[model samples]
Target chain A: MTFTLFDNEERMAGRAEAALRDLDFGSDEARAAYSELLDAYRKSLREQRRMMRLGDRLQEQLSTVNQELVRRRAEAERALQQLRDAQDSLIQAEKLASLGGLVAGIAHEINTPIGITVTAASILADQVAGLRRQFQAGTLARSDFEEFMTTADEASRLVLSNANRAVMLIQSFKQVAVDQTTADRRVFELKPYLSEVLTSLSPRLRRAGHRVVVECDEGLEVDGYPGALFQVLTNLVMNALQHAFEAGKTGTIRIRARLFDADTVELRFTDDGNGIAAADQGRIFDPFFTTKRGAGGSGLGLHIVFNLIVGTLNGSIAVQSQPGEGTTFIIGFPRVAPARPVAV
Target chain B: MNIHDISRAPTDRSPEIQFDPDACSLSISGASFPEDGAAFYGPVLSTLDEILKALDQRCVTVRIALNYFNSSSAKALMNLFLMLDDAAQAGNQVIVNWFHAADDDTMKEFGEEFAEDVRFVRFNVIPTAVTS
Candidate 1:
């Protein structure tokens, strides 16, 4: 018969007594042996009771430790979530700072064309007043009249052209700036939209003595977030202007776009400047990884570019560079992007 | 009477078992939580019984070092100690060394409890830096 020592003493004793009684023991020595066996069994029962008490206490201590571990894990998770929220706000601030820079750059660009237009209009008004006086006094010779006409013609032409240039600048700036700020999603012609982005960035390019060459086919269109694409292109151009060329040196930045497949379009941005070093190339897109940390690099330029193209635009980007040759960032994305999930 | 030696390998749920008839020594180590305690310990116990029966006032050593064991294994262990106690009563030298980790109070207490149950055999509950 199998019995745990946890069974009550009286029950166990009765079982042992019954077993001994059933056994054929013909001598007193055999009975004494049976009595010794009963004693061992009772001692084992007491041992089991003590072991049960010890096990219960151990189990209680283990439960407390497990609860402590669970609490620690939850605390770690909350800390991690806080870190993520802080990072997201920092990225937002960076985006707004870039947009502010764009606004300042466009304002500076519009000033020159508008200034020339105002100067030409004033000069035309002064010439008209001089011509009126001559006509009233009857001292208007054929040569004087002809000279006045010539001056008027030149001044009006200058005013018209300069005024139109100002209008064009404002138009392109408005489209690009609004798209970037609002993050609008729409179907847009790739060629004209790219030129508009380039126009908005022309002041920075001119100041840096760098030229951008755009080679995109006419009538090619993308059905995606134009604003996100604008941010991506702006960040890329800004990154090249900041790092690709040395100060006071000129470089050519080429942007070429074409249909990679029926569903995808590939855009390659190449710069003919000092290429990135081998060790720095891989970390360029990492946040806060910058060679110009103290001067002006927030290190989020390429990181923002990466997030925009990959996260917002649902695209892929890769870079190929040689230390002395140049750098090329090749980006490929679907012509029709998938819808983004609504953020909570 | 010939008593064969017993050697059983440890698994995820059971401890290793090694019995040497010539030396009259048995060592069980590692964790023991087998699904069926009787099935796992039946053959080993029978072999141990044979060895104890064949001994004539001979000495035997048993080493038990388990990190964790379930209720059923504990019961089997109790049975084993009872058999050793029977041999010691028959005028054979029996030494049982129970090894536990120094920090493991539960196992240490278990060893102490097992020692109290056996009146004849030398049950030594030893605390070590590690349990094997």
Candidate 2:
């Protein structure tokens, strides 16, 4: 409002002197008021400059902080991606390890029959050698020959039957093992596939004195990955065997399957054994949270089951259990599972 | 009498186990995933036992280089390391060298775990470049 007061100090002082010489102020009081106005205007200008400097400093600090935050966010994202990759690889490794255990089980099963065959074959070989020596010496008797023939026949039968059994076991195992290792989607009948998985698990079941009674409707076909289904079923059955029952405790597992609707199917797995505690039921699906630590429990079985059902199959599962009572798992999945599985 | 050297070829399911008493060294390499883990590692364990018994405080090095192994094989490895630890405690210099791929964090972590379990044995975990 007063341009003279805003001029440089030398110019303002000259203007004040000129005004006084020209008698511009009407009285002494008026001159004093003009001087005071100049002082206030100079003070206000100083304060404005100081505020501008402060604003610049604050802006610089904010920019530095923003840059640091962006860098940290990028680093955190990289770390998170690395963690995801590690988790994926570990899950796959666990699956391979489970398959390795299955292979070991089948091998042990086959070894038994092979051992019997080896013993029987050796006995037959010895009897034939004796017969050859007796015939060569021209001292072979009819009773001796008859006895040797009987022994050979019995040994042959034993060898053949046991060898045949081993072959059958291998064949059945081959199908289940192949299905387990591969994840290619294919249409398959539900009931028979369930039976195959159960049969493959027979050795574990028998060892634990557990009986599985499957009640599936006939001709219930599903369009999905049998391999995934096999893994899901295997995990459920093994979980029950490991966690549900106590040592030397005979338990019965009932598996029932039916069509939930046109596009979905429902499967119920129940066991009459020790149930999970209420506190632990929620965290049961968490990876590596096992109550049986140091007792040969990997604690990944149920986690893997959960991943397969929800992540791979695009399905849902629920568990209902109470302490001292039986535990039941209900799973619902689309008849035709998703074409591509969701990566973890 | 000294323990004889053992040389086993690698199979699809098991690793190659080579133990040379003359060299005072044993090396197991490749994927150690056997159908019958106990049966597969049984002879190796027994041979090591015999060598340790006859070692007479001689320094022995164990080289374990596995790309993959199952849980059961992990148990077997634990037992093997324990045996070596015992031998070391008995005044035998036992050195265990665990080799893992540079990018294999899980195997490296496993090596670290095994190292924690053995006190007397000189545990060395070395990361090497991954071969094609």
Candidate 3:
């Protein structure tokens, strides 16, 4: 283990000198042996220095690699964070796109009724103008007057009915559309609000032959973001329509709500349709998982629902279902939702 | 020798990467993002390595259509393109097609960036119609 016989070459040289002085220099054999030993010692020192240099170079290389890896890891983390943000914004965009589609459908629905009303009103105006001319020129007849009155009454009725229909459609659209676009908080009654949401979704419901009934206690009020609540309900209703019911099959969606506590509310949405299979029930909330791939399903419906409930409404959701027994989604949240919704 | 296809489904973060070894085609579509870009691309790089090694001077075609990809993914892609370049330099035929949506200036720029370092491989920045 004691590899170094001397601390330095000076000590080694002193030792060698003392040994030479004590040795018999007259013997050539001894002189030769001493010279060989000196050569071996010098070679060992040279080898040691070379080994030290190699070790230093290896350490430097390792440090460089470590630094490169650290930099790369940090870069990867930053990229991942950026990707997450991009994905989140895209999800938000999908939500807004859905709202846009709903608005377009509502507009189309309102247009037909309003168009008929306009035509009826114009016809009635023309009749009035003609009748006024007849009266002023002293050419008015009893039968003509009676016919005019009858036409006026019929036109008035048509105008009134259609105008009322348009007004109702617009009012419903205004309420639900406003909630979809804005995240502002307000105090509102629950039962009527649910009614408005269902009315706004009538176009989809009718198309799918699905009926949604809301059962909430009267005079129950909540101070929170109705927009978030609207989104949650919309997603759930849409999910049931898309997943729970078979195509062209009529299904009943029942939404029952009650106060869970003084500050909390429980809402249960049950659909009497083909329920989710036991295996798929677990991953229904996973993003981009759809049994209806290549169809109209985006697979973000339930995921968005989960996010809105937990993130926006600060609530929890659970699902109970069997293949033939139908599906029920039970959601519980505070009556007063968070002032500002958090991003999931 | 038959090379199996390498396909990964798209997630909220990352895009789908698919390689059809029999067709000598590899495609990347959707969002190119993952928490560990290198790890995600590691198998891709290795797969390319295997394909190139067995290519025997045959042509390999790479088609890339990524709507969005982060910087880390960009790096992984750069490495992949370099590997293709090396393969081409070794006398193997490599053709790389970089597709970007017409309205996506960012993706166009990325295609250009990847194209800059490629010489041996026939690299082309192709403009595609906006999908959504």
Candidate 4:
């Protein structure tokens, strides 16, 4: 079609139709057709510009609103997180204070058995020296030598028992401290660790007359902080001893270390004392929660134990305790080269 | 609104951040160490993986401005940088702009730690006004 639409002096092109699309106008016209079109078109453009201005203002307001919401939410979240952190820190601090209070008691409890063990060993050494001198004399007989050997064995037995007793006492405290304090890590042998820990706890065991059986893992290798694990074992063993054995009675504490996984070792400390109460089981890991609260007990023992195993050791601890039966603490830790170097 | 990126500030003790897929730029600013940093940042990196595919332009610049991250988060950030390196090496122009304040030595060291791992991409430690 050869239609020259732009030839006319109409500055507004197809103006009537444009307004209709913008706001739904009707066919009814009030003024001259061209004037109607122009006025409507201009008015529509003016309205659109006004609406755009309003929309922009609304968008700006919305942005400010959104930013305000975000800022408030962030502040609220930060405050909440800080609240949680403060609570956790307070718990840790409380645990530390209590541990400090009990440390002396633990040390004292451990020293007695150890001192006796040393004294017994010293006496035994003297007796062995006397027997040696007697044997050197020409009049000394084979029967006498045999009797001396037997007596020496008895003294050795006494020394060994006392030594172990002293060791257990120290170990309990060590375990409690190790769990509470974070330290550097290193590679260590398992058998020695088990013995050392048991030695430290021996005094407490003796006081309670709890016999501890050790089934050490042969050639076991560990690649984390030893002190932390030491603390964990100490707490578990002593916990078994003091709670498992009735006052004025005796009990048995069994410590078994074995390979749990390709790169993990599990230590199981079990005792035949009456098991953890069903009520106390759930609250055991919660800091400062303890049934033996009045007995100079720093209720942070298990909580510290759990933290050591899970936090410092990067492992797990499980307790299987039953009322009137016994309690067992099973801990598993990586036994090979750690993925990262531990701060030792 | 679609700013889908988060990072640990060089000196701040905060959490790690994730990038929004819809934004042209992603930023991570804060201290990171929420207990198990590996567990937290693991999924966030995975989330950024899907969003990176939707970008049509051949070039993507990801800025990492972290103040301080724990060892665990440090490992996670390494993994993340490696991921970006992979994407950048595979015909997608990826640029990693690591921003650090001039005074924060720790953040600078951390940024260099990742830069050491990256093979194909260019990593720049932009020293700006970083308040500790």
Q: Top model by lDDT, which number?
A: 1
Best by TM-score: 1
Runs in model 2 with CA error above 4 Å?
A1-39, A127-154, A241-252, A272-300, A311-314, A323-326, A336-344, B1-132
Cα-based TM-score, every candidate: 0.60, 0.58, 0.55, 0.41
Pairs in clash, predicted candidate 3: none
Q: Whole-model lDDT, candidate 4? A: 0.68
Q: Give the Å error, residue A276, model 2.
A: 4.3
* DockQ value of candidate 3: 0.01
- Give the per-residue lDDT of model 3 (tens digit) for A108-149: 788878998989999999999999999999999999999998
**Stretches of candidate 3 above 4 Å error?**
A1-79, A125-141, A338-344, B1-132
For residue B60, model 3's alpha carbon misses the true position, in angstroms, by 67
Model 4 DockQ class: incorrect
Please rank every candidate by lDDT, starting with the best: 1, 2, 3, 4
- Deviation in Å, model 3, residue A70 alpha carbon: 5.2
| Model 2 C-alpha lDDT per residue in residues A79-144, reported as the tens digit of each score | 999987877787788898888878877877788889999999999999999999999999999999
Per-residue lDDT over A1-344 for candidate 4, one digit per residue giving the tens place of the 0 to 100 score: 22221212133445544544464334445334655767776676567445644554555566579889999999999999997787578656755664563565577666677787778788878877877787677667778778877877887898888887666655655654663465656677788777766665565577667688999878887877877776677667656655777788788888899998788888888888889988888889886677887885656677878887887777888888889998888888777645664331
Ten consecutive residues with minimal summed lDDT in candidate 1 chain A?
A1-10
lDDT of model 4 at residue A157? 90
Question: What would the TM-score be for candidate 3 when compared with the true structure?
Answer: 0.55
Query: Each model's C-alpha lDDT?
Result: 0.86, 0.83, 0.81, 0.68
